[model samples]
Target: MPWPSPPVVATGFPGAVAPVRVGRQGIYDRRRTLVAYELLFRNHGGASADLAEGAEQDHATSQVISATFGDFGVGQIAGDKPLFINLTRGFFTGELPIPFPPHQVVLELLENVEVDEEVMAGLRRLKDQGYRIAVDDFIGEPGRLPALGLADYVKIDVAAAGDAFDEVLALAREHSRDALVVVERIEDDALFARCLAAGADLFQGYGLQRPVTLEAVSLTPSQLVCLQLVRALTGTDVPIREIEDLVASDPALSLRVLKTVVSAATGTKNEITSLRQAIVMLGPQQLCSWVVLMLLGGVTGVDTESLTMVLARAAACARLAPAVADLAYTVGLLSGVASVLGMPEADLVDTTGVAGTVREALVQRHGPAGAALRAVLAYEEDEPCAITGTGHAVYEVSRAYLAALSDAMLTVGAVAGDS
Candidate 1:
């Protein structure tokens, strides 16, 4: 299916490209190959935000939509794989627009969204429109049984279901006979074996692979310049001309700025030839984003593997928990700084002039951002249990890792080629 055009906002940029984060987890068929990915929204402190009601829910949903379709194109994140997106009551009832084409997305109905007559009717209309539906967090609750009839997929949280896992699994299979019964939260080989033995059609969890650890290192002068530029851009207001001067001061940074602008403006009639023009054309916010990416990729003394991992982790953190995009990105990026610089995390935190929350997250892994960092780290290290207390779901962390890996590979390739 042809991709839908991204929504444009007042900034003249696609509104969907606005700074929003999304997390995704892979769903695999019995054969163990990836078939689909369920996208999630990460709130402050690394927990999955309660996307059930009010404006906060709306904003979170919108951000996930924007990031998935805009900043990180669906193709880059999931390729031809269909995406599973959780829908709140507003989206389920058509009160909110479902911008995704039916063929490309599976509309997952959260368990909390009442499956009443009106919602059932809405589901019918949507199904006729070619949208597949999934019943999320299904534990065979009596009230949610109505949705099982229309569901194309029924997801059971193995951990939450506990002793009733088998019964609920059987119930989902019986009622939604045609629906694929997906057993999720498979944290270990034992759990995976149990689910597979129980006849799950699909599977997901940390048991498939473990997360890796990242070591520390040092930075070069040019990389330090890029960091300074990021600070300047994110800090007090600086004029476009002054920002141009900062870019001009570093030959490599200047080249990257020009190249990025030219690349983004591809197919335009005019060629961007200078630093000032490039900075102005890309705007400071975008410039900062690019520079931050560059810093992650350009660290001089860091190993290519290490840098790539850090970049991926940072990007994933931002994508997974966009409510704290700036802080999340920072934490993700700098989580490796102390190690890279061969210093302590506390020392790095103390010197960076970051917010107390940022410091706590960095030094102690406290608060929401800290929880987010912890989740990302846990996912990276393949420690599913570590994510439990952080308020993030195993799937959410997994999705962030997968998506970030894609992004990091691209960034690393671009930076390597440019260098």
Candidate 2:
């Protein structure tokens, strides 16, 4: 499999050395877990925060942002920046891979999904637990109203979504005036002005990170091991002892764990031996979540990483689902299972004999249930994700998804308890 380039931003370039490319995502000024001045940079088609040359100030700033958020070449965030990460359906279900701190991150929900009631309640629970939530495409919907009412922030596109937008913002304000409403896709000055007039509290789009060419970087074997362990830890049946053994399998991973355990940064300064101790110390739930989130930064073995992604996406859905439908719960994570394993999605489909709706979702993105299953991919790309429509409609659908996920995990945990 080919290696994908790591996300990067030019640290510095002579006003002449290929200009720095940046794409921006607006964070509500009132956001507690997001950076207001967040910038996503592109160098060629890749992300390069390493300023081999250019202005000293630009170089320094790039290092701070990239190092703080781009895994710092270790697949981990710098801990200083507001935790901002794209939230996808897969992530909600525990089907995809993640590589950061969820407690500190803000999940920017997209606007293309088919959410249900279960997903909404689950989201409410997550929100109660301290996770910040934001809805993209702040459109209105009947079924989605329940979930939308619960969101902390709402985002809209002034040019496309409009006074229809104001109506939605007004609605959000009516419920939670403190809820930050963001206007995305601001093309020019006039639109920006309109957004201000409409009470938009945040902003995003090409206005932030420019598209650049890609530059692929090579990784050492240790990096590979760390990623494998992350994948292993995330498996539905993975055990704490298994995770410990995998980490202990390689000296590099051992060192990474030691550093993480002792890093005054993570706020945990505990000591452990072997991998099991680390798992026990960290707690399987927290340990697994951290390992998966860390891998979100970027890892080697494109295929494995992609599989990890599919899994993470599915997992996110699981986290959201009220009832694991059509094996959509497991199939969501496993549908892409073959791709990452280097086998054919077709063969996996044949062997797993997954339900037709699920297979349709994976192959064509068509089906009512698929909306719940496939939304994971849409979430990963951060594209418009819909779960009914804007307002509380989509929110309700998201809640339905989360409910199913909670049920599945609880059932699985209980079964595991008996074992």
Candidate 3:
């Protein structure tokens, strides 16, 4: 088990095993982002501990794949839209957990292992069966062509071999016309922008995002005051005229507010200038909405990481339970509050107004939604077997549905599921 980092990236840990963070991440695109991620394994049942005699079995080692990864595989990212995930050769050859969908989180076959006929045949089956295939860490291995042909995407580890980036890109182009060629592991702003220019459809790694600091941005004290005034309007009790007065006090705030008023997509546009007129036009409700939205959009970098995690998790849950997407959304949000606020889940669920079914499922594991919650948690843990009781658990369509629920959050969006 290791400590977790980043919003979306999760790694398996010995403790709660919430969402196992995977190292090495990339989104194919930011706006029209494709779902792509990497898993850093602590154990695949091949490690020494697995071989040790009478050693306490770490049967839970694959929990990350079951509880988390599976959620992303079944269109949890963007709702039936495609995403990509790395699949080790071992999983193909051996009994490794593959909790995600063949459609979403398209398998990026690892390069470290041999691809026998059986493997190729299986991949062909998956492709024919509607799975999207991808080749990982590909560096022009002629032997990989068969697999690549079945794959929908080819992930080139540009950072691993930067000197030969051009050649790899060339090879990638030849291999992928309908298939996407992703430039992964871009680690700096320069590299990020460069990859985009080089015909890269997707980008991964931490270089594009960094901690946002308000101090660094050039802003006058008056501007800061105006921004604070904008932010303060979010409180429900704030009056319209005061908000208008605050904006009027600073022309910059008024301008920002006016532009936002027209540009708002969710709410009707209101056009007005000056303090009192603006208040009358927008009214209290729309003003608050605009202020809150502006504040949120302004938050960047680490500031938004926790929000991303909550939203992504909820999105996965939504795919699992469209009927319960709202409940799952609330539960998912509450589940992470402890992580964000340095508290415990136990301390907050009662106060959160979480429905009885979700509360029981989260806490006692004894309610109707318990199994569903467990399935989602198990998929995150990489334990596809959890859906079925261990050895009793056989890969089935039901398990696939559970996996789909979580994964759909990433591919689709949050959906309310049944109890």
What TM-score does candidate 1 reach?
0.47
Selected candidate, larger lDDT, 1 vs 2: 1
Give per-residue CA lDDT, model 2, range 83-171, as digits (tens): 44435454443354333444555665545444565567556766776777776576665555555666777766666766586786677
- Cα lDDT of all candidates, in order? 0.65, 0.45, 0.46
| lDDT, candidate 1, 1-419, per-residue tens | 32222111111111111123467778888777888888777543444565557556656765565445533456555777988887777777866666545767898888778889889999999999889999999997999998999999999999899999999998998899999998878898788878989999988776763322111112321555566677788877777766764554343344345444533432355533233555676777767655654443323422345455656666677776677765666666666444444557676554333346666766788766678888877776667788877899887777677777776666556444544
Best by lDDT: 1
Off by more than 4 A, model 2: 1-70, 73-79, 93-103, 205-245, 251-266, 269-281, 290-419
TM-score of each: 0.47, 0.46, 0.41
Instruction: Put the candidates in TM-score order, highest first.
Output: 1, 2, 3
Better of 1 and 2 by TM-score: 1
Q: Which residue segments of model 3 deviate by more than 4 Å?
A: 1-24, 30-36, 42-63, 67-83, 209-419
